[model samples]
Target: MSVTESKAKTSVKTSKKNVKPAEAAALKEALEAAQIELVPLSALIKSPLNVRTIPYPVESVRELAESIETIGLIQNLVVHTLPEGMSGVAAGGRRLAALQLLLTENRIDAGYQVIVKRVSDELAVVASMVENNQRVAMHPAEQIAGFRKLSEQGKSPAQIGDQLGYGSRHVQRMLKLAHLAPEILELLANNTLDVEQCQALSLESDQARQVQVYEQVKAAYSTVSAHLIKRVITETEISVTHPRFVFIGRETYEAAGGVVREDLFSQEENDGTADRVLVDRLVMEKLETAALAIELNEDWSWSIGRENPLQNYGEDRENYLLLPVPEPQYTPDEQQRLDELYATQAATETYEDEAAIQVLIDEIESQAAHRQWTDEQKASCGVVACLHNGELCILRGIQKKVKTPGEADAATQATSRDLHVIDRKEPDAAEGISLPLLKKCLPNAHWLFRLPWYNSHRKQWP
Candidate 1:
């Protein structure tokens, strides 16, 4: 037998033994006296005695209408007779509004009959209060389970939302939560994990990963935040905004079979990629290709690519001389165009326009500042192409050979002596000068010691 049938039979058997004859008779009478009638849609009106005086949200009314359209009304409106052949809905004000909405939309005619339980004026207020107050909302876990069941039944999220009066995105989120680790779901059911924490955990598709993060969070802090959970979950993954990821761009990375997962709970445009190794490989390959192109096109001796050459080379970077490239002289037409751009930039009132104009000016100047090495420099030097702030950075005319020990030693000794002399004079100078100001002046004092007047008076110092 069906569970409902079995339960019904059990209820009948229990009532037969427990219910008194007089009590049964009274219930039968009460059911008969309660007047249920089919009232026309045009005759229904909101009663002033309704306990819900606050206006229903527009979305609530719309959702109610959608529910009614899907399965028709499930509950009868409790209403009372009015003075002019109309009925005032004392209990179901929102229901009456939803019916009116349907009528206004031409989905239902004004003459359509509505099921209403007619109540006396004296009992109307009580009925309205009872209907509004005497209800329990379903738990979130139960709602999620129901949504999952519907999804298993081949119902799309949009279809389920239309039938149940929920937004599609809300249904989608609940569906995602339903797929979380069993342990996490149990915690959610028991009120240990909240909706937000569950949402964060759902970002990881693997149940093992979700459980691992949850246990780590539980061990670390007494109170776990959604942000903390997400951070822990995505710590090993590369962020979409990472320099290499941004340089590659989303479309290209996806085309290369790199998967990106978007963080729905994040306030900003945050996303993560699982393929960190692939991204690094692609970045290096692209950088090397760019370096090769620059070497061939510019007639340089050689070129190499490094992610961050400065950090990689460390103190050795000092041995290479970075040749300064002068900006090219603008032609007459180029000069006139630049003058017009400057005037437009000055006249622009909005910050956005000013920023755009500045970008244009910078681009033009960058093109003009292209490095042109002499034939001798090209044969002896090479270029280093590296990444800086998600963009390609080219260090041109970097000396290929290291400096001689004699030259390096002489430079270091001069620097050390200059610093030592400044340190010695600082104590006496501190008596009259602010320490910060004196410290700032000391770095520039190396040039001061080379002055003829200062050298002539050097013997006067203590």
Candidate 2:
């Protein structure tokens, strides 16, 4: 109107030029590859996807939101619509979490526009599994168990490979451990063995030989890894069963900390005892200090510590380091891997998969080139995940930068309604023993042989 009071003309202004063409093209390609389309969060209110499948680290999303506060949601998730309308999260739960943070801060509109990719139904599921396997960092036990469940549910290695975007060999390796003998499995369950170690055991043609090696290695119980054991087995051409003894000597001092009482125990002491002295399981908790709890299979394994040889050593309990049966110390060698993958936690459902993942990664990265791969590479050029439910439960491919199958828009969406909490209760004691757990409604039950947790390194000392 000011252009000319009499002419009524308007001026057309243009934005500055000279933008980065490559950056623009890259952004467009990324958005397209990720299958991003504009949509609203209300549409994703009740996604059918279980977050378990798409696990990630909370820290990652927090970092992303921090970036978003300065920048913006650079990309979006891929989703599909139900019969009614555009709805549900398909893949990219982590991405959604990042965007939500911005909305919560009022930095973005409550119902702002969001871009998403329309992933296929099959891709949706595959993406979810990838998120968990790689990002969530699936536990060794869970990986084996999940594969077994899939197989039991009529899925084969090839099928699992196809669904989870794993190579047939990769799936086969995991399946190999899943089919180990019960003894081998028992060691794994008890944190005495790992998957590669189990895989190494599988190489033995003779089942008896495998068991012998297992027992011997377990007996020696050093931190030597499964791969090292494999090398030794192949190089030495020796029987897998190599006997290792538990040799621990404690020096008792009489005044001035001088050595007085010294005893060396043989392997036989692991399970046998000289006499029957009732052990009242007690939690010797020191104020301001770490509480002491004795668990046979936990710290001082009863299999090696129930000898009761040290009980009658002295009347002054203060001057003596009173130990329950075994002293709960692993030989320096095997102690290194006591916290390895598949190692069960004392009071948690979580499992560590670091070593197991390391093993699997070594196998996957050494493959041939120029092959048509079924899986696509990961989003951030590799993996990005979170710790959920107290553990890294996801098992996705980071090195391969690969994406799994079974992806599509999630039809249902869910937010964490509540956090998981471990219920702590005092052990019910009976007959000087507090039952760690009551079986068959027996509130008072004491177990045999105990190893105190104070010296928890190896904690399986004999």
Candidate 3:
């Protein structure tokens, strides 16, 4: 047999908790001390004032009763027969249902009262549900539905309360759930939403409004429950006015003719470099500016930032914004043109043109040929930073300092210097005379003497 059937068979009562062996022994001892009788199902006549006039249904109770009537009632149910000889359950709904069914099926008399251990009404109810449904929990939604059905049938909350043995407040709370929309009801059943959502929903009058926001909430997170939604909905406004979230499918992105550059995410994952992010920053800035420019009215325009990884990621690296913008739209003809013009992604790079980069390579190689560099590119490797003409230039491995006697004397005068002076160590060939001295220079000639950037931070250089 399945566990349910086996449990039902072994259980002496419906809606009753199982006995702890020690507790059961204690109860047995108490029963003996109280002088209670263990009566068979065949004894104790039913009272005229039974509160539950309509008996609960039971199966196989008849067979059991017949077996008892013929073989004699075996395994008498425990009971604390009152001085008045009345019967009530301490722990047996199933046993009572079986016996009652037997009587109803004419296998036994209706007047029979099955024995049960006498205990507090509280203990009886708690135990009853535990014995039957610790595994099969009656959902809160179903309970509310049942209460609503009874209420609709003209049962007052108090009457329902008495019948269910609960306070009127609980009945009212359950009744409120019936007011929510059908979709919300389903969420409750599915346990996607909970009491909190319901409580918040109760405050709202508009069903459509509730539904619109509910869908947004459901879309935002996969695992939240209906009860939770109820709670969240009250305090958090998730609906149309500044809706809490936007689920923009890629269609939306491409719909605006966004020409995506290289997928930054893939590059970020691959290179893990500051340079890649710099490209992203520039792209986002261009995209935002472009978006603003295209819109006829600034009031109607919208833009979103590329998420700042540092703001969210770490303290070691200060937060930096990604300035990239959405790609400009492509007209069909322009797209065709771009598709033909560019051969590969290398063609999309912005910082360098092929001719310009080739020139820089030639410059560095030529400098390397004559400069005395320790390791060419690294520290103490006799390198000078310089901006030759206008292009960014890096001359590697220059051995000699290009100072004339006067320049050498000036260098001695400019002491007590910060990192800029130290960094300005890259020699500017325009300011000096030595081929190898040009080695170790910044390709961008402008950076040779002092960059405006470092100066803003209060650092100065010669």
Candidate 4:
């Protein structure tokens, strides 16, 4: 029987927070709520009056399905039942979707029992709106605290995760957040610090160090992201994946008493199944020391190992721009090798085979090794190390300016140079010019030629 025609009727228990004052009062007198019923999966239908408008993320829906599979549905679906074999979901659309996913996966049968609360059409929209919009989401800090409490009650991360329907790793990460300084947690609650920043902060186990790093960034900038926080905290460290480290060789670096810091969480690049070293400050220094030897051989009067902001801008900005580095020229043999590498790469690309692709990769590496800087270019240029796209980029042979007589002021020269660099023919004038107008500029071009427009419109003897 339809919910409207059923003999059973119960008054809805409404909370002030879940329902509006008018909705609560109106529902109290005008509508009758029904008790929960176990209906077949095929009998229920999604409500057109459902209040959820935003599409849920696919990942979230998938996780919900996992949760449902792990520990059956905890909540009942609300539906408005009609007499003509039509039923619409009034609330719990997400749960319904989860159930549907289970059915498609053959995890559940067509006649699988679904707990549903049948309501009348009159209260459908309001019931959906209340269920979706009224329930507030818990703050992240509170969630972390709850997880920590569960851990304190002698539950392992895996056990807690199983009960909560979350991954063990996620549960452990949440528990870690509960250890953050209360001040930092308060900032997170206030929405001043985001989840990423908190995660970065959690990297430092020492509470004092976290606060110190936080203050350092806060004092320097108005706002900070997780990347900025990590940059400040790991200022001395360098990724082992850095090209400079590979060039120096790990054995030579370790012989020089350099240490490599490995991340316990991340895996190896080759197999992606084994743990590997992540970063090293000592090894980075050893690599820099090796680079310094190269710097000495170049014989610059004076040079800094790193890029100096003062040297790149302000009083030195003009000098930096007025002088340009000479482009490296390759010898004939080098050019031939490069051409061979390009041909090999092209051949490998044409035949989509793995072995050919591997050979192409090796040839490209050889091509890079063959190219060398000219002696004169190296003599005049000094090397500077700078981070480019988060990797060490060694800039060789950057020239120093020699003052020239009768030169324009730096600002004016810079503006003129900027305009020259961006110079291009604008499309507006070129696109509008007609063939007749274009021909007018040519020698003896005026009456010798008639355009189609002129020839077609002119009066002719017939």
The best candidate by lDDT is 1
TM-score of each: 0.56, 0.29, 0.27, 0.32
- Per-residue error at 108 for model 3, in Å? 1.7
Off by over 4 Å in 3: 1-86, 126-130, 133-232, 235-462
Please count the clashing residue pairs in each candidate, in the order shown.
0, 57, 58, 1
Better of 2 and 3 by TM-score: 2
Show the colliding residue pairs in model 4.
Answer: 47-89
Q: Supply the global lDDT for candidate 3.
A: 0.40
Stretches of candidate 4 off by over 4 Å are 1-135, 190-192, 224-227, 244-462
User: What C-alpha lDDT, on a 0 to 100 scale, does residue 283 get in candidate 1?
Assistant: 85
Task: Please give, for residues 419-451, the per-residue lDDT of candidate 1 as tens digits.
Answer: 211111101211222233323446667676677
- Looking at candidate 2, the ten consecutive residues that score lowest on lDDT are 275-284
Kindly state the number of residue pairs that clash in model 1.
0
- Candidate 3: RMSD over Cα atoms? 23.6
| Tens-digit per-residue lDDT, 222-275, candidate 4 | 777667777776666655566546545566656766655433222353111111
Model 3, 259-333: lDDT tens per residue?
222211121421111122333344355434443442222222232322221121233112112221112344566
lDDT for position 186 in model 1: 76
- lDDT values, one for every candidate: 0.65, 0.40, 0.40, 0.55
